[model samples]
Target chain A: MCATCGCSGNEHKLTAFLAMKKPEALTGLTVATLPPGARPGVQSFAPDTPVKTVIELERDILEKNNRMAERNRGFFEARNILAINLVSSPGSGKTALLERTLADLGARRQFFVVEGDQQTARDAERIAAGGAPVVQINTGKGCHLEAHMVHQAIRQLQPTTDSIVFIENVGNLVCPSMFDLGEGRRVIVISVTEGEDKPVKYPDMFRSAQLCVINKVDLLPYLKFDVQALKEYARQVNPQINFIEVSATSGQGMETWYAWLGL
Target chain B: MHELSIIQSILEATTNAVQQNGKPGTVETIEIEIGELAGIEWSTLEFLWPAAVGDTLLADATLQVRWVPGKAVCSDCSSSFDVRRLYDPCPGCGSHLLQITQGEELRIKSLTLVDKPTVAKAPLRWN
Candidate 1:
């Protein structure tokens, strides 16, 4: 209906802009090679030919994702499934904690893990060793997995009645906080090796998380990490956050971690 | 990272809309309204759209993303300010308990396409 008012014509005239196809659906990464254009009748603004003021982005990039996420949440709710998203910096032992969790809970309950990373099926393999259905989402260059991405990955994952799906998001504390993968609980994992200042440094990640996992507790003796300070700062940012301190390697503190997972 | 899949959902929705409207010869552009605090990354969405479209019916379609600002209502002063600026404590009084109203909607508002000009008593060209 030419809703851009008449701005489409202006976009067509951009300097040697490569012809592009608008996507009907997207997965990992979706890039638009062109810029927005202003059209008449419609108030949609467009980039000028040579110069223009900074475009004020009025679109919420996550809108479509939330729709699919809502659908997913509904599906999970109908089946009484609990989905937990695990976020952390690299080597915070997300997989390890998950592995321990599955080991402790698999006999009593069913659990699955959907691993997201820029590369590698390694985490998936590790979880598979933990005796659970595992799905790996290789984002390539992407830092987080959107709901649609998880939706597709869920198909490959073996579904169970009242299942718990733990999504190990990409090894980033920043970008993953921006995207919602339709999980009920968001758990941020941090390791003592990364130092205690992480919670203060990455407040957004901690603020967005419903739970905080401090992994590699056994190594506390070797490092200069202050567990007490980290916990305090994390509490300051998120007062009601659930904290779990564990050593996924030595198996110490795993019982409490499992308890926190409600396993 | 996640935007490509979102674009896919938009495509699926629009394609259904277009088909229901009687398959148009070509699809032009899709207009969507995105609000802040929707927790989506615009740069990533724009960065991953081409791959999502590829050479489908939307191969030539345009993705117009409009950013919607988040309005925060100060619990103390009952004033509204932009949340992105982290408008500390309402200008009237210092209060951090702000309630965010609106600015979380992500939806397809409408679409644009070129069809045979509607004319009465004029020969209709299938082209």
Candidate 2:
């Protein structure tokens, strides 16, 4: 319908739509990053904020993310897929272990890969090429992936008999340990490239990990990583943690690792 | 890092609250209190908020944070003391057998949205 005597509304609309661009990045949010300043305890914005104002909303928005994770866990439980979350630094052989597991049990069991990275889809691409269904989630400038991200990624993946969903979290030794991704097991993978003191330095990551993977044993001879000392430090943090020494490149101890996964 | 997902959660809860309260329009602000030990970066949440709740009720809402420090209690003395995330041991007794008393909480206390009933300027009626 033309208003004002003669213009094609469709053309005008199309032109407007074509000219539309992505939203300009937000400003004024920089102030939000700072800690709350004490001001007799009231943080009133420019205008009156409606909805319950009797008290400060001491809420964690991640609550719903956690709930969604539980639902995903239930879904996995129903299908008998032991969802395992693997967190580690980059090049800790998280994908290498996956590749070997896929090679060993590709025909025997079902598996899927949920790869998370700040950028690049190479890991997911590799996992998918290894005969396992994989979904790549790019977290761009983000440090870690949460359970809800895994839930969203898993929804698109095809499920199969005795399936396993391995959520390879972003390479982070700090923040990833905090968020529970509804995994049956949280496996922390570390390579010899990182010092043996890593377990001691980053205890929270190792303490919460259900299993610790000491990967890249083939390079152990090439490096000075103390295997026994690393194991002892992990033991000090977590009295009882299942761990294994493996070389994904040489296929030295991958069988034991896979056996633990019941693959 | 996963604040994008967290933003989605805020939107869902805000939407439900809106339906219950019968409010309309975008959420101007959604406040949340995160424990220091909750391991969430305030900057990260702010960064991901827009992306996660894109054009939703909470799209432009401010994520107000309340930082609550962690506390641990002594099993021997039953006394509670402040605790740090990276370190172990109690500040009161210097004992490592302390249990977490508070500060590892990840819960939504409440949300703030525009109430339509209030906005329409209906006369206040006493019950």
Candidate 3:
């Protein structure tokens, strides 16, 4: 008797029974007859028999995304757009910084925004209210934004030439680090409320970022967050990273931030 | 997880390769190389593999992975060292200004395929 879905003896009966009752088991069955002069236990390939072939690819797994990003880069370069990708952990005050920046420099520069969130149009609404054209991308179950999504957003927004496009990435630090959004600069936002060791803990984000914005400086007086230590840690991970300390709510250091933006 | 997306990309690439190669044969094994600094969790990838490859060309194919270690060279001291994490400073100069030389790879190395019996096509030519 067979061990699984027991059907004894006759080979044809056993195959038919398993095919009807447990079709998956049929996959493991070798019902084909052997070729002439082929031994039962030993294997031999005839001169004309088809053989296994190994195809060497050695191709990057993210080739598709990288190609798309290059296309985006070309698009931005042709239009003279300064594309900035903002990445951070959730509740790190990315929207607040954008809101303050838009409010302060709305008269001086033309700004376009691409907001990414797991689910919501709230950030896009806020950007629109600030008088800048914006598009919100709901990733559904996606943890990070890809270049293709930003390309689509740019098409929808139809940003003019020589403008700044701020792509506020989905508020996740891990997965976003691996994706290149073809941005002119990649800024990482971290508030004083979070741990000072965030840089070392999530080194990939800091290592890839060009600018590190330390937000919520207004709340520094009440908290034990060491600003110097945070800066040191960030430097350890990324020696070339520039820092700009700001409090979006108190409007402190906004001028420096604007200056960094060349506005 | 990002690994799921990576798996999907692998599947798409494999499918495209098969189509481009004139629908050669059924895949037997796929070999991949993942670096330590690639930002992928191997455990999560393993756990999600079956579901991600189900009903795809890679369903019955065996996955063979090769892990690559991280390596970096310090700019200030001009010394090379093994890097396990990006936060690791240069051992010689204690400088953070290090250039990564390796261990960021996420690539498909090769695919082994068992050819179909009916097709008598010429051998594939590689440049």
How many Å off is the CA of A101 in candidate 2? 1.7
Provide the TM-score for each candidate, comma-separated. 0.64, 0.68, 0.87
lDDT of 2 by residue, A1-263 (tens): 54422445422211001112223422222112112343222232322223333223444566665777788778888888888999988878899888988888888888888999989999988998888889999988767887778888887896665788889999888778867778888999999899887876876688788899889899877888888888877765565677898988899898888789885
DockQ of 3: 0.34
After superposition, the stretches of candidate 3 with alpha carbons farther than 4 Å from their true spots are A1-50, B116-127
Interface RMSD of each: 14.8, 15.0, 12.9
Lowest lDDT block of 10, candidate 3 chain B: B118-127
Q: Per-residue lDDT tens digits of candidate 3, residues A162-238?
A: 89999999999898998888898999999999999999999999999999999999999999999999999999999
Candidate 2's DockQ: 0.21
lDDT at position B48, candidate 2: 67
* lDDT per residue as tens, model 3, B19-113: 77774677899999999989999999999999999998899899999999999999999999999999898999899999999999999999988
Relative to the real complex, the DockQ score for model 1 comes to 0.11
Best by DockQ: 3
How far does residue B100 in candidate 1 sit from its true spot (Å)? Answer: 2.8
Candidate 1 regions exceeding 4 Å error are A1-75, A105-108, A137-143, A146-163, A174-182, A195-207, A221-239, B23-29, B39-65, B74-80, B85-98, B116-127
Tens digits of per-residue lDDT for model 1 on B63-86?
776777877787768988876632
